[model samples]
Target: MLALFKSLPDDGSYNVGDKLIGESAAEFIDDITDERVVSYYDVDELLEDIDLINESKALLIAAFGIRSSIWRPKLADAIVDGSIGVPVVPLASAWSDFPGDYEQLTSENYPQYDRSVVQFYQYVAKHAPAVSSRDYYTQKALEGLDISSRMVGDCAWYDLESLGEKMCKPEKIDKLVVTDPHQSQYFDQAESLMSELGGMFPDAEKLFCTHGDPSQSPKRQELASNANKYGFEKKDVSGDVSNISFYSDCDLHVGYRVHGHVGFLRKRRPSVLLCEDGRGLGFTETLGGCGFPAFTRRVPEASSTPKKILQTFPEGTIHQLQRKYLGGDRVSHPTTPARDDVVDQVTDFIHQELTTGWHRYEMIPAVIDETYEREMKPFIREISNI
Candidate 1:
C-alpha cells in the first residue's frame, strides 16, 4: 500500500507541507517496454509502465485481483531499476478485488511518503488532509483512526522476504475450510466476527468463493447460509483456489472478498481486506475530506479534483473502485444506500482488521519515518534522473 507520491495542489503549486505525487503517480510504470504499453485503467499507462519494468531484472507481477493498475507498474519498475534493488513485490489479496490490494498489501510494509503510493494519490488529488470515506462518526472513527495512525511515520522496509515459511503450526493443515461464496453485503455484518475468529482460531484452513451467484436472492441465500453454516469451504473461483503456489499455502484468509484479498496477499500469507468505510464516493465530499484514491488514481492531464469540500464518498470500494480507475471517470448508478453501507462496512472492516486491541494503532506513518532519509532518497534521486 506504499505507493505514495502526492504532488497535485491544483498547481496553484501546493504548499501545505509541500509533498505531492498521488494518484500513486498514475500507477507508475516508468517504462517496461513492449514500448511501454500498459492499461489496467491507465495511470498514465501506469507511469509509462514504471518507466519500463525498471529496465529489467526482477518483476514478478501476478495479482489475483488488486492490480495497483498492476502493482503500480511493478513498482515503478522497481523504482527505475536502480539496479535490482528490487522490492516491488505486490502479490496481494486478503480478499482483495483491488481495494488498493488491501492497503496496497499493507503499504508494502511502509516507506516512500507517509501514506505512500504517491502520497495517498496526492492527498486525494490536491485537497489533502485525509479520512472520511463517507460519514464516519464514532468520534470520527476515533479521530480518524488516530489521524490515520499518526500519519504513519518512521518507515523502513526492503529486508525481510519469504513466501513459504511462516507456518510452523498455523494449526496443522488438512482443514479444507472454504465457506460459500459470500455475496457481499459484508456477510450479515461479519457473522459475529466470523464466529469470533472461528472460535479463537480453531486450527486454520478455509475457503468459499460462492456457490450461488445467479444474482443472489433468497434473502441473499439466507444471509450466506448463516456464514456458510460455520467452517466455510466451497471453492471454485477457479477451483482449488487458483494456484499461485497453491494460493500461497493458505493458513488463513477469512474473506468478505476484496479480490480474495488479492489471492492470499499474493502468497506472502496474512491478508484481511474485509472492506468498510461508506457512501458512494462522488470524489471528495468526505472520507475525511480526501485520502486514499492511491494518489487520486493519477490526476494530471488537465486536472480537476480539489474543489475544497463536498464529494468524498468513502462507502468503500476503496473510494469507489479506485475512483473509477483513478478518475478516468464514472460515478453514478449503484447507490442503494451505498450498497447497503458496503454490506455493513465490509463486515466492520473485517472485524476491525482482525481484532484483539490491535495495539490501539501505532506502528508507522509519521509520514513514513520522517520521509525515509529526508524525503524518499531525494525523491528517488530525482525520479531516477539519478
Candidate 2:
C-alpha cells in the first residue's frame, strides 16, 4: 500500500497547520496497515511521477481540506491511461463549492471552473470505489457533479471520543481565543472581542493562540499585544501535536479556525467556532446538534457580547454533541478505543478494489463523454446560440 500525502510548497514558507491533515492521515494508515509506504509530493511532482505511482499496488490520496480542482484534468488523464497502475482511493478528502457556486460552472475561474469540477467528480466516480467526505456540504457538492460520496466527517474526529473522556471538565475555566487575519472583516474586531472576554473573566487567564505560521505571526503579535493590554497572555503552540496540550490547559476555546475548534474538542474542552464561510458553518452544523455552538462572524451584532456568545448553547448540548459526533458513552469515563469504522470501510474498499483488479479502461471514455455533455456542452451551446 502506498499513501500519497500532500506536500508543502518548496519555498518552505508553508504553515505547520497545513501539515496536520497529512500527518493525521499517515498516522491513521500506520495504525491500520503494516505494509504501507508513505510519500509526500506536491501536485506537480505527483503528475510528473505517474510512472512511479503506476508501480504501486494501491494508491491512497490523503486530502483533508477543501481540494482545489487545478490538477483535475491531468490526474483524470493519468488514471484513464492506467498510468497510476492501481486503484486510486481518496480517504477522508473533501471538495467544496464554497467561495463559488457549483451549478453556475461557466463563470468561475481556472481552479474552480465547470469543466475542472466535472473532471474531478468524474475521476472520483470512475476510479475510486468510495470517497470519504468531511461534511454534508462536501458530500452534496460531490453529488452535484454526479459522484457518490460517504460523509465520514473529518478524520480528526475519529479519536476524539477517547481523548474527550480522558479530559477533565473544569468548573471555572480560562478562555483561549484562536484568531487569524484571513477573515479580514473580523480581523480588526478580534482585539475588542478579546478585551471584552478578558473583562468578563477577569480572574481567569485569557490566552491568544494562533496556528504559529510566520506569515500570520504579525497578526498574531497584534492580537497578543491586544491581549496583553487587557491582562491576557499569548500561548504559542509549536505544531498540531502541541495544540492538544495548549487546548487542554485552557477551559474554553473560541476560534475562527476550524482546527482551533477541533483541537479543543479533542481535549474534551468546550469550544465555539466563529463561522466565517461555508466550511466553518458546515463544521458547526455537523457538530451543533450534538454540542458545539457556532457564532456567525458577519453577524457581529447578534453575538455582540462574549457572555452572550458563550451562553448560546447549553452545557448539556456540548456533552451530547461530544457523545454523538465524537462517539462514546455519555459518562466521562473512557471506552475501549471506539472502533473507527470509517477507517475500516476505506481499507476494505482499497483491499477489495485491488484484489478485484478494477480497471478504468472501459469506464474512462464514458466518463469523459458524460463530463463533456454535462459541463462543457452547456457553455458551448450558449455561445453557439449567441
Candidate 3:
C-alpha cells in the first residue's frame, strides 16, 4: 500500500484530488485492522493516558509507509535547533531515482502562469516549524494574505452517505479521496469539512467517515464552493460491492491526509496526493511524508501554457532537478528531495516491508526480502491487531 500526506488547499479551486486520502485511510483499515494512518497531530492527540510510545509502536503503522530513519537525524537537528520539532517520513517505493521519465518544467506544456499570484510563492520554506516568536523574517509574512483555512467550511459539497453507495458499485470509478474532517475531536476541523465533502462527489457510492462528526451545530459558517457554485452535487451510492466493486477497481486515489490514502494503497490501489504546501508553513512535512504521486497545490494557470510548450527528460532523469525546487516553489531542490524522490523513498520502504511479510504476488514485485520482513513483522502485525 502507498502512503499519502498531502493536504488540500483551502481554496475551492481545482485541488479535487484530496479525496484520495479519505478513501485510502478507510481501505487500509478495512484491509488491516490494527493500525490507523494519521497526521502528527493525530500522534499528539493519542498521547493522553494512552500508551503513546507503545500504542504508537502498536497501532501506529508507518505513515506514507515511511519510518523515522530517513528523516530522523535531520529531523532531530531541526528540533535541536528549534527550526522544527518533528519531521515526516514518506512511504516511498523501492526506487533509488525517479521512475520512468518526465518532461522538464516549461512555460508551455508544463506551463505555469502566476498572473493571479500577487506574491512570488504563496508558501515560503513550506516546512519550517511555526515560530513561537514572531521575528523579522516571519514578520515579512504579514505582507501576504492566506486563504487556505477558507476551504474548511466548504466540504458541505462532499456528503459521505451519498458517496458510499456509489463507490460500492460493480463498475469502476476514478475517485479522489479528501481526508479533511471538519469537526474531528482532535484536529478540531473534521466536521465542517466532511459536511462540505459529503456534497461534492455525486458519483461516489460510499463516503466513509474515518472520524465521526455529529450533524448538529447551532451557528456555523458556510464555505462557498466554486465547483458547487458552478453546479456540482456529490452523486449518491446505490449498488453494493457484490454487484461490482467500483472502489476495488479504482484507477487512482489521491488526498491531503496521509492515513486514508495509505488505506487505499494497502488494499492495492493507485492514488495521487495533493500537497498542502504553504509559505513558511508545514508543507514540507506534509509533502515529505506522502508515499504516492504527490502534486503541489501551487498549480500554474492555463495561461502559462497558452499553446502547450513541452519538454521530456530521459527515464529516471526527473530527479536531477532537485536543486531547482529547493530555493523556490518548484520540486527537486538541492536542500530538499525532489517530488520524484519523495515518492520513490516512501514507496520503496513499504514495498520492501510488505513483500516478505505477507503472501507474495508474483505480478507485483516485492522490495523487502525475508529478513527485513521478519524484523518488521511485529510492527506490521500490530496495526492489524488494532
Candidate 4:
C-alpha cells in the first residue's frame, strides 16, 4: 500500500505539478484534523484503496483548477461511491472555462466541451454536504447548475496562520524571482522582461523558478534552455511545501503561475501574478487590491502580446494601451475591482514596495483571516462531527 502521507524531496529537483496539488490538499487536512492521521492519494490510488480510505473519518480532497474531460467521470464516480458511507469534501476548487466556455453549456452541449463539469458537480451536490471554491466564477457556475457552493478563496490562502502581523514587504530587496509560462508567446515575453527587471534590481539575486518538469514537456525544455540567458539562477521545486519554502527568503516575486504567486503571498512576502488564463484572473478577483491581468478581457487581437502590453507600461495608461491594442473594455466582476483598476493597484504595489522599500499592505491578508474564521473553522467543525 502507498504511504498515507508521502514525503517530498527537499533538494528542489521535483518538478511535476501534481505533487504540488496533493501537498496543498494535505496541508489543509493537517490544519483541519490537528491531531488526526491524514493520508494522501492520487485519484487512481484513491479509488484503489477505498476500503482503507473508509477507515478515515472523512475524505477531504482538493480539486483547485480546471478539470479536463478525462478526469470528469473518474472524479464524479469516486466522490459518489466514496461518499456513500463517508463524507467527501473539496477545498479551494474551481470549474474554469478555459480552452472553452461553460456559460452556455447545457446537458445537450456539455459532452462536446467536457460536460463532466456538470456531472462532477451533480455528484457533489448529492453527496458532499458542502464544498468551497477558489473564485466567484466557480460559485456562479455551480449556482447556474443548481449546485450550491461557497467561494472561500483558494485553499492555499488558508495555509498561513497569522496574517495581520506577518503581512509585510521585505525591508530590503535581496532576491528577485521570475516564472515563465509554457505558452510560447508568453514565454518569449517573460524572457524579454528579464533584462528590464534586472536593471530595476541590479544588486538583487535573480532566480527563475520552473513549476513544471522540463524533461516531459518540449515547451519546458525550451524554457530551461532559455532561462539562463537572463541572469536568473534556476531553482526547480518538487512539491507545494517546497515551493512555498523556496520563496520564503525571496524579497519579491513576478511570475506567470498562479500557485507561485499564491506561495509567495502565503509567505507574507510581496509578489505579482501574470495571468495566463481566467483561472489566474478569477482567483485574483478575490484578492481585493492584489492581482493583474496581462491581456484584455476578451480574446486579444493578434497584434497584442504580453510583451507589447507590458512595453506600454510606465508611460501609457492601461486604458490607453487597451485602446491602442484593440483590447476590449474591462468586464465588471460582481465582487472585485475591474482588470484596469487591478493593474493600477498592482503597479503601485510594485513601485511603492520597490522604491520606498515598503508598500502599505491591503485587504488580502486580513481577508484570508476573515475567510478562515467564517468559512474554514466552521466547515472543519461541521465535517468533524460527521
Question: Highest lDDT, which number?
Answer: 4
- lDDT (Cα, tens digit) per residue for candidate 3, span 1-386: 21222232222222222333333334433343444444322322333323333333222212121111222233233323544223222111110122211221211222122332223122211332111111111222222223111011111112223322222221233353434322112122223333343344345533332211111221111211212332232221211212113434453343333323433333444433333222112221222233333322222333444212312333223333432433211332122222433334433433443445322222111211221133223322432343
Estimate the TM-score for candidate 4: 0.74
- Per-residue lDDT of 1-386 in model 2, one digit per residue for the tens? 46464544333434344456556555545554454565665666787776776665556665533444334455556767777777676655555432322222223332333576467557655866556666666666565556676665554543322421433344455554554423333445555556565665678767776555434435445665666786766665535454545565677665566666666655455555554444655565555421121222121233346435534543224334544654322222121111223223323332343344423122322332333334323322322222
TM-scores for the candidates: 0.22, 0.63, 0.27, 0.74
Candidate 3 Cα misplacement greater than 4 A, ranges? 1-176, 180-251, 277-372, 378-386
Task: Point to the candidate with the largest TM-score.
Answer: 4
Q: Which of candidates 3 and 4 is the stronger one according to TM-score?
A: 4
Score each candidate by Cα lDDT. 0.31, 0.49, 0.27, 0.58
lDDT of 4 by residue, 1-386 (tens): 11232322222335434455456556665666554755654455556767777776666656544343333346466565654256666665666443222232333433232466557656666777677776776666566666677776666665645454466667667888887663344555566556567666678898887875545546666676776676777766634455547677788888777777777776677778776555666767667545566544343333546645454333213333443454332222111222334334444567776566544445567777787778776775666667
Candidate 1: which stretches are off by over 4 Å?
Answer: 1-160, 163-188, 196-250, 255-267, 270-272, 277-386
Q: Could you give candidate 1's per-residue lDDT for residues 1-386 as a string of tens digits? A: 12322322222312111111122122322311122322233234435555444453333222211212323444344345443242332211101222222233234332222334443323221331221111112112223223221111111111012312231223233343233323243444455545655554456655544422413245444654565555654443422222223555565554443234333432333334433321112111111121112112221233234411213333233334534564322232132211323334433543553463322112222222333335333333332332
lDDT-based ranking: 4, 2, 1, 3
Q: List RMSD in Å for every model shown.
A: 20.7, 18.0, 17.5, 9.1
Q: Model 4: residues >4 Å from true position, as ranges?
A: 1-21, 64-72, 80-84, 99-117, 160-164, 297-349, 355-360
Q: Rank the models by TM-score, top first.
A: 4, 2, 3, 1
Report model 1's TM-score to 2 decimal places.
Answer: 0.22
lDDT of 2 at 348: 39
